[model samples]
Target chain A: MVVNASQDDPEKARRFREAALPYLDDAYTLARYLLRDAADAEDAVQECYLRAYKHFDSYRGPAMKPWLFAILRNVCRAEYARRKTAPTAVEELPEGGDQTPMWNEAPETPEKQMLRRFDGDTVRRLVAALAEPFRETFVLREIQNLSYREIADVAAVPVGTVMSRLARARAMLRSAWLAEQEQAK
Target chain B: MTCEEAEVLIHALIDGELDAGHAREVEVHIEGCAHCAVLMKEYQEIRQAIAESDLRYKAPLELRRKIEKALPQPQPQAAPSRRSVLRGFAMGSAVSAMAATGLVAIVLRNDDEQRIENEVVSAHLRSLQAGHLIDVVSTDQHTVKPWFNGKLDVSPPVIDLTAQGFTLIGGRLDYVNAREIGAVVYKRRQHVINLFVAQTANTERKTAKVSTLQGFNIRRWSDRGLNYWAVSDLGADELSEFGDKFESAMRANKEG
Candidate 1:
């Protein structure tokens, strides 16, 4: 089916798409951060969209981004719970098996140069390495530019908790970033 | 307020979560207190750096497609009618042929649905031993059902068996690849069973077929092309009994 289905009501559908489109990428990215797998993240985002569509009738807000994100957050949590139970074959690596060190420190070559962006990639890896809750709060507040109330609504937590967690999450991310900077020297 | 409290509020002030009155109070406090102001600037810089770093992820395309297919379709109409909701979770219909054969007892060339039962039972036991009880969690059936959207094509009927002594722990997205299957997960006195289902046009299916594999007991049955497989490490007799109850509930729901 063409997902961009505005056949019956072009104007209504277009408005929906216009409002929904910008958030889709951010929603999926947040899902990926929460889920750590490409497939599950996609599932979470799609679920968020469907939920948003079904409830679109009830939406009485100036904007739909926060409402949409709240749904995405739930989908991500549910997906995380499911994956936690499912059987997976995890390859064993060193105790702190973060790839940043190995890949960054590896001998430079033309092929590796094509794949380069040592610092940015390192930062990305550190972000992923943070604990799920911390990383999620950090991403939502700092990167996604969501308000504390919005994050609270999305995370299903109190605003006070969101504020505290955001503070701690930033502290953790900053530490991780600093550590990476040190390691790069 | 002391510097400690003011310092924490500095971050909050930057985020604009602080009320106007509190913001004014914090501003006055920070103006009089240089230390808090400096801390506020540091928090702002940290936030700005994070925002400007391009650290935010760009989801890959495959991830987007997979999620789009997996997410739940809106079903405002499906709400009050419980049976229709469960029927929407037609497990057999969603699965690929291979996983369809794995979770249900259908089109088996062999005479033994018993063997299949046993194998499933063993797998169930492994699930328990491994502490893999459920993939999704929500008391609401709607929440649990959408969990399998992309992972399985047929919606496995999620029946809350809590009143029947089997608590509906949740639902999970299961796979047979290129065909998603739904596994309506339930629990009974610490025992977990995955009720794998799919839609099919075939009826006149067996009521009960029991087997044991890997120290687990299983029962397989089908009513109206919807195949049901119940597997547990619980014993053959007990599993058979539970299967009877489950099948009857399903039948009553269907007929009524």
Candidate 2:
């Protein structure tokens, strides 16, 4: 391996640590959501940090959160590919069709129904069941609280796409919740 | 705005992503339309539920510790500025003070091995970066070994292991730890290995010590009053095999 001279700079490393270390929790959270396992999340986070440290000089952004999260997301995707256990792609349901008609069927008491659907495990399963694009956008927006612009920057999508994905993701989660509720009954 | 249009903007409104005019428009529509109002409330509840739940997983303490421990130690930058040279001169007196306090000897003894290891690795890396891995390129050990004559006080043993898959490429003169040393370059397939040898007065031969630095494998041992360090990006098993072949060939040459 030919070692590049620029990589030996200690000042660069110190700067990288200072800029990137604070995002460890954010990285791990995204990784857990993406990879869906604690140990795999930890491993991906560690690999992400190492890769980030190596190319830190190339990070010319104003904020490091989106940059670090982007790398963590890539690492998780690669890990998912390696494991070959990515959630199988479900066929896209027709937009506002009979398959998910329950979305429009108003519960008699909206607040009570919303509380019943918010059970932690069910919410987690619903989010995890989303396809990769929607799942990533939802996790970034709702869970990580990134703005649409920030989500666009991290996911390398347009802001319009981020908005659409978030909208579709929420719709899917609502449909899944309704379906799961029907199964329970 | 139609109810369908308001539906598209409901999530954006709840997320604060809409501009004021559009947001006010959506608010007005939702207030008058009971269906849009209920859908908006549902989106708000979903977002709030996610925010209030224990969804964000905190990285475990042990994972944090492992990551922190594995972080690479920063390599000390070698600055050749005039100010640093003057600082070094001033530090000579500080060294004497440390010696007077009986701390210099132990520090120097430990530092010597570490400094040499770092120097050898740096030299190996520099040669690769400079694209000058050899002073004289030759596959035959006889031609390569003769090239070092009269240039150094001691000649490093050169051997050909073409039969064993490690083909001797050439030899070069490299400086490590302020002393001239011999770097014998070899190849196993595509991986290049640098074998650094220098004459030393310490005659105690020891078994090879293996270490890794920055993803490179390093093997060091002393034999017959010469110190040998083999550094490469090759696998440990292949490097150890190269070491064994080199050592045995050197011993055989000495006996003959």
What is the iRMS for every candidate structure?
Answer: 11.2, 5.0
* lDDT digits (tens) for residues B209-244 of candidate 1: 776666666677776656677766667776777777
Q: Give the count of colliding residue pairs in each prediction.
A: 19, 0
lDDT of candidate 2 over B151-218, digit per residue (tens): 55576888999998899999988766544578999998888999998765434477998889888899
Residues A59-110, candidate 2, lDDT per residue (tens digit)? 8884788888988888987886676554663344344332232335444344
Backbone clash tally (model 1):
19
Model 1 local distance difference test score: 0.60
Q: How much lDDT does each candidate structure score?
A: 0.60, 0.74
Q: What is the alpha-carbon lDDT for the whole of candidate 2?
A: 0.74
| Best model number under TM-score | 2
User: Deviation in angstroms for A106 in model 2?
Assistant: 9.5
Chain A TM-score (model 1): 0.73
Which residue pairs in candidate 2 have backbone atoms (N, alpha carbon, C) closer than 3 angstroms, thus clashing?
Answer: none
Candidate 2 ranges with C-alpha deviation above 4 Å: A1-8, A85-114, A117-119, A178-185, B74-256
